[model samples]
Target: MWDLDVQPLISSSKWLQLHGLKRNKLSFSQILSQIGFQHREDFVSTLGKFVASRYADGLFPQYLRAQDGRVYNLTAKKELILHFVDCLTGAIELYKQRMEWVTSESRQLFGVIQESCITIVLDFGTVCRAEFDLCRDALSMVLSQQVAQLANDIIFSTAQDLVKWQQKAVPVSEDSVESAVKWLWKLEHMPAVSHTSSTEALLEAISDETIEAVYYFAVGDVPKDMKHLLLQKVSNSPYAIHTVSFNAREEETIIFLKELSQLTSGRYGEYYYCYYDLLISLILKAIQVGTRESLQRLLSHLAHNKKIKWLNGGRELTVK
Candidate 1:
């Protein structure tokens, strides 16, 4: 129900007045500016209106059912319309708060952040990117809850997103370290003994540029070249890799853990997560405990002790 005291222009037959509407001189943008007063406000208003109209009569704003034209009447379309306008208006209002930081950022990190996610996730939960840790941290500060924990989720999620985008990345012959690291994130199965032409091709395509270490998240096996090289080449901390894939019978699991352990001079135990039964639930538990203190200790321990040269160029990305 809407207020009878406060009326909106679109509440009644105001729709009739604008049905065949064609403003003579003013451009749509200009009209939008006038209606919403600010560009951000206008943007939110437009989106909100569309969202609300779709679910105008629903008990909740997010879930809406369209009229079948048989069972349902035209209903209170104005309620839906007004709902959207208000919703959109609210989005802009809150967005303004975040923009304060967005405006301060030299890099338009917020803009670069996909808008589609802001409502679905970021509005309430934590999010992370290269340097967008600040927002997650800010959310925790604002809520006074486990903000850092949320940051971990964001980092993991963002890393996953980066992996998703790797397929489109044009690999370089030399400086393909970034792509290599990203690709490593996407791999679910380890390289089997089968024809690994695709995996080899992916590796050969990696440039000789300095790559500190890469995170290879695999469920099954790793390549022979990788497995042999990782285990035999670096022997300082052997259990490091074993810890990660404790149950990893696959060669790929052996390789990832070994390489990571060697990369961190046996400090891979910091990031290593092993599971006996369900690794999915195990990973979730790992995420919850990965705090700033834990991450710093893990990284600092790795950074201080230099056993292998691989970790020298770029430090392994810890849970932090």
Candidate 2:
């Protein structure tokens, strides 16, 4: 048995010798210790390289289990892990790029519409849900009091309306024309002590200020229970409501948002994957035509055959 052990030790020593390690003793433990140390050093170096490769390639492994239970070569396993790391790295970089692009595009779009005196009603309750940085950046571009007031009013009204609608047993129509006519009549002829006192405050605030356009940035779908009531309030308003739905997927939600815009004779647009592109397009169109066309069209319907020549186009347009 001693001889058998000695023979294997000698064979291992010879193998080490072949690999350029000159050893005099045929001790199994000593040979194994040396080999193990060298192997560990090699493994650490290879691991560093694998990490670097993954970072550079921006990828990572999708699966750890092989198709069959057969043993894989150690080198192949390392390569697979490296590939996975590469994919993960790539995905992160791409996301950063998209966010940067969106920010830049939004800034540019806002710049174009800032002087248009457009009242942008940013729905903090929806999709983007009023992310701080995004809202700050957008608000920074426009310094109009009307825009600021509108933003606050929309947010407040959304919350207040949701609560009020939930408490009330009355039913509101979703049709734009009927809602608008009824609401207008109520506002013009009715007393301020009516049930729509809160709505009257909102309308009075906006009407008192000169507003060219009302852009509603919907981040998500409105709650189903509040849809009809909210729509009635929005449609009844005198201001044209331009609804821009972002990242909305539900068919009913899309239709509802679109219908609101249509009912108010406002523009409706949807942005799924690229919000920046959609916003840029909307702003560009607004800049090209100017809000004068919309104002004139609105006036034509309300005034009915009155020849209205707009003097000093540079002055902010106000609907009285």
Candidate 3:
């Protein structure tokens, strides 16, 4: 006496096949991994998509007409669909509970990044005041106050160094080895008030284990010798260095920073006034090494939410 609408199940089967999932063999575990195993909420959200799709395909009718034109009870089919839905829900709930248990046991583990230290190197020597403003604005929006305070402590001296170097009698050419050595010495030994010794001090202050990340805000060309020395130190450090470039017009500088990011497994971003746009770019870069499945999930979510518009007849993502 158990019966249900056959049409919706038929559509759901077709939908599963269209998505390359074997309908007959579908399981909660498979679905969870497909969505994203790292985040329980994402798994649940994706499961909701399948549920919605089945509902949209008319999964709720109480009766159905067979191919033979005979009216049939849909109670059994409804029960089956409900059972599957319940399975998905139960799985997500169980996973969520487990996550809660783990979180409770390791209360100090979560959000520990906020407690870590990050060094921010501001290239004030080459960057103009306008560029500095942009850097400040971006940092204010993206960084937490604690992190900002850490950055501020080191940034003051680095800025002052640029000003001191600018006022010096000797012309410090970008390629001068003598100038590079002189500034490098100043950066290491000079007091914060005498020179912008922030970089060396920042590097010295952070141990390989204590430092979380390094942010280099570059506005203009970096001297060849200084760049070499900085890159050497960064390579030896355990943490990655993320470079944010502002109005970097020099070809060599751009290439150098880009290569530095790539070699160190760090992120490189060009500062755009639009923080959202910049964030998206950074996210894309971070996930460039992820699996195709991950990319597909992201794209599907973006498409379904209408956050991205398709262009070139759906072959391209429209820049909005």
For lDDT, the strongest prediction is: 3
Clashes of 3: 7
Pairs that clash in candidate 1: 56-80, 173-207, 174-207, 190-221, 191-221, 191-222, 221-252, 222-251, 222-252, 241-257
Per-residue lDDT of candidate 1, residues 1-320 (tens digit): 22322122121233223321232213333333333322111235645642213333444223112342111223335665475466556545544544354333211221112111011011111111211233333322322212111221111112112223233323232233333334334434222333333233223222212222222223223445655553444333221221222123344555565565565453222111221122233344447787776556445434432331223235543221
Task: Give the alpha-carbon lDDT of every model.
Answer: 0.30, 0.41, 0.44
Candidate 2 overall lDDT versus native: 0.41
Kindly report which residue stretches of model 2 are placed more than 4 angstroms away from their true locations once superposed: 1-104, 107-115, 126-132, 135-206, 273-320
The digit string of per-residue lDDT tens for model 3 on 1-320 reads 11122111112234236432244334644443333222111235645642212332333232323444322223334466676677666545544543443333111111111223454555544443333454554443333322332321222214335333222122213333234334433443212242234356336434434456666666545567666766666555566666666655456877887877676666666632322443364358549858776566555434433333333443645433
For candidate 1, the per-residue lDDT at 118 reads 11
TM-score of 1: 0.20
Cα shift from native, residue 189, model 3 (Å): 22
Top TM-score: which candidate number?
A: 3
What residue runs in model 1 are displaced by over 4 Å at the alpha carbon?
1-164, 167-212, 221-226, 229-256, 263-320
What are the candidates' C-alpha RMSDs?
23.5, 25.6, 21.8
Report the number of clashing residue pairs per model: 10, 13, 7
Query: Per-residue lDDT tens digits of candidate 2, residues 95-184?
Result: 454344333443223312222344444443432211323443444433231233222222112222322111111222233223323332
TM-score of 3: 0.37
Cα-lDDT of candidate 3: 0.44
